[model samples]
Target: MSALVPALEVFLVFLRLGLTSFGGPVAHLGYYRAELVVRRGWFTEAGYAELVAVAQFLPGPASSQVGMASGLLRAGWPGLLAAWVGFTLPSAAVMFALALGMARWGEVEGAGWLAGLKVAAVAVVAQAVAGLWGQLVTDRRRAVLALGVAAALLVLPGAGAQVGALLVCALAGWHLLPAPQSTERGLPAVPVSRRVGATLLLVCGAGLVLLPLLAPLSEVWALLNATFRAGALVFGGGHVVLPLLEAGFVPALVSHEHFVAGYGAANAVPGPLFTFATFLGAAQTQMPPLWGAVIATLGVFLPGALLMAGTLPFWAVLAARPGARSALAGLNAGVVGLLLAALYTPVFTGGVRGPRDLAVAVLAYAALTAGRLPAWAVVLACAAVGWAVL
Candidate 1:
């Protein structure tokens, strides 16, 4: 009963989060930290930091992982399920509705708000890189490793090139980067019923592995499978998942324009950026609007549940391992590099197109960092600037 209380409360709170967590992964993190950590006594600051680290290592949406971790901390399996569903449902529903409207009305034109929205997105990611880097890349050697990784990602173009670069950087950081002077605390231990967790993991793993083989090959299945894969392999955060989804879906007939449009829209909406999957699923093929809605809803969120279920058994074990900790440290550095690259290329270069844009961005940054403005306020103010200027 005591455990259930927190889990139920988390479900309700995250339901609200899913509905109104606009501005993508970085923004979502800000909201979560603000709402859950600072405002609510749900988790300690250190505990939230640990969850962020662990979530970055896993291959799925980072926010979903954070929510799942929050759920696990509160309850057990039921709590995890509740968190995933609560966090995912609101955005999924909205994306599905948007998809239906898109089918009826055609590509949403004159959503001129996206221009400013994307700039805000950039500012948010830049802030994340700055904040996380200071926390994660404490030493000079680690900073050098981060810079080298950023360089490789910028220069290289190919299959797995970015991933390979990240792996190499992680290895370099692990071997060459100085260890923390004070030992880092390991993740909390959650004692689960071994049989139940193992059963859940096996079932989910098997279902995900076999779904494509058994199901009919079509655009729907492809989108579902691709999204599932994206949800599985995307470590770090939501922005990091973009490239993988672009590589997987765009080449296979998913329109780059639609994808970018969906991403832009997702940033405007409040919720997890994983809702981008919902958007993609709905727009995958020119199916009936209802079909699109249903398919997209299922496709986007199925992986969240499966990934959590499958990974549950190993959470305690993996968190306890020294090698895992070292690898996670490296991955954390890689994540910092990835965020840094995002800051430079798409976020910075694309957003700050001219002197006015630069001025707006600098002002926004100053407000966020120095003036201590709320994130949503900064975003809204920037949107106003984009409308007036751009």
Candidate 2:
């Protein structure tokens, strides 16, 4: 296939996913495996599995990165952009509209509806954690590492705490992640060169540095810098990045209520949680909603996208190493821990105010994980239930 042909194909496939894929980042991975691995035969099951590991190992929105990487596999850079755009468009549009409405109507008089979304987030993250646990936390050492990381974050909740957790996890992963029994793997091809991948990573880092310096001259550059850096450094993907983004924009650019509510609103959407950036951008008072939305969205997403452009080739080399695979497994478990930590405070505390709310969330969770109902349907059901009972 010509580059354009495959890129177009990727766009269409992911656009469909954008519409229907729900249950947050980890759930999106299951959907990707179904569509790309089982349905389209774009990759063998093992190949798709390896690709997901790569996405988990890198930063950005893990699901979005997986889609973009798949696109890159299909059609290089154009495919990367195509995959991201197609998957992101639906939720971004929906979020922007909701955001503008929030700015105008001022946080929806029907706070219950928004609360429905927050409670739904509780279910979504719980489902994601449960799904990841069996896969990532296989051994005792990894299990302890995961739980320890979660506990550490809970004790100290901030950007610094997140970075500290990852660093500690990295050390633990190195020690704990053991060599796999089977060395039965082949290296996959990538569109970028090692040099290109390295350069892209460097650029991401440089922007995180340089743009902050420019922030003094132009305020927008500060927002851009903050968002981009947050996107790049974030591991475990979309939901974990919340505190990073919250620190950047909250209390300064937007109010605490708007920021917290944006988190709730994000769970209600169908696409990437990064679209929370779109909501944040629009919620800001300094610029017009469209302009802020554009800036924040681009800033938050650019880091991970650029890092992929830089890291794919080198990642192929790393994946071949048993130590690296072991380390990635440990890190992934740590990621699950991070998600578990997030589920407690913000997802549980923010939404599950009373027993009635908890019941609604549990039902929503059962519908998603057990019933295997589509997440959109679950959200609708939860919202109506929240209105009536919660």
Candidate 3:
């Protein structure tokens, strides 16, 4: 199908998902798989699995990256753009509103609502890690890799550390893990040329290096640089960006409490966790909050978009290779490890300040596991419980 024929379909589908897909990045992928792969037959099971593998390997939000890749497969670059914009619009807008509101009443509102949001985040992330553990960690080798990566990141936590851990995993997978026989089911061809993708990738790297240097000249430049670096470096998506961005802005551009609170509030929203950038930007005093949100959001997500553009054309060919498949399996295991580490530090320790908080998180997790309540509903339920008891 041509780009135009699929552009509207892509936008509408993602917009629907954006309004309702709430558990986090992993949950978002599940939603996409159910809707696009299972229900719609948009792609084969192998194709969907390959997208997840590629997205897990790339920096930025993995679910968003997968969604964009699906778009590229469906109708080239325009469809990719449409998919991102549609999926992100609802959460981005909600986050912008929260950012503006936080400037006025963050402390007051955070007492109850944000508290519940925090615990809710804890529960949601826990659920995601639990669900993904089985699907991704099917073998003893991968299980060991997950444990190893999680332990290493917990001890030496940062974006750089996370990247290093992933590299180690990839190398281990390459040498230690047995290579599989190639099952080169050809993937749907995207319209982007290899040359076009390469050029975009080069631009992304240059911008990553140049943006921060320009920060001294302009505040916006600095914000972009910080966000760009956050986007560019990192293996695990969503919760993993926490450390990268925390070191970048906390106690300088934004306060520690606000940074943490924004994370909690972000969970209550639908769409990509990267929209947390929107909140961080709005929290900034360097520029008008909305403008800050816009630029920061742009800066943080730019690398992933450019990388997707550069890589989509070549992803199918590379993913079909047996060695590449093994490496990606290791990478997914690494992400699962990162998720476990995050569950302990930021998701659990950060939110569960006391017994009451832990209780709330437990209830939320139970609700999520029950599958009776949607994520947004669970978030609201937690908020009510927090106000009444927490």
**Model 2 segments more than 4 A misplaced:** 1-67, 70-76, 95-103, 107-110, 181-189, 205-296
lDDT (Cα, tens digit) per residue for candidate 2, span 148-184 = 9899989987546765676577667777677554333
Off by over 4 Å in 1: 1-5, 8-59, 103-112, 157-159, 177-183, 191-198, 213-292, 312-315, 322-324
Pick the lDDT winner: 3
Could you say which candidate leads in TM-score? 1
Q: Cα miss at 210, model 3 (Å)? A: 7.9
- Writing each residue's lDDT as its tens digit, candidate 3 over 1-390 gives 453878888999888878767657755775676567545778754456557666766888888988887887786777888898889989999888987776544354457665776677788777757766766677899899999999998899875787788878777777777654454332577788888989999999999878878989988888988899998885676888889999889978999989988997787677999999899999988889989998988888888888877887787567667887777667767877877887887667767889889888888888877764556577678777878777
lDDT for each residue of candidate 1 in 249-320, tens digit (9 for 90 to 100): 684645887778777666556677777777776766656655655665565555655555456557556645
Instruction: Order the numbered candidates by TM-score, best leading.
Output: 1, 2, 3
- Full-model lDDT for every candidate: 0.65, 0.76, 0.78
Rank candidates, lDDT, best first. 3, 2, 1
| Candidate 1 local Cα displacement, residue 260, angstroms | 9.3
* All candidates: TM-score: 0.73, 0.71, 0.70
Q: How far is candidate 3 from the true structure (C-alpha RMSD, Å)?
A: 5.2
Candidate 2 global TM-score:
0.71
Two-way lDDT contest, 1 vs 2, winner: 2
Residue pairs with clashing backbones, model 3: none
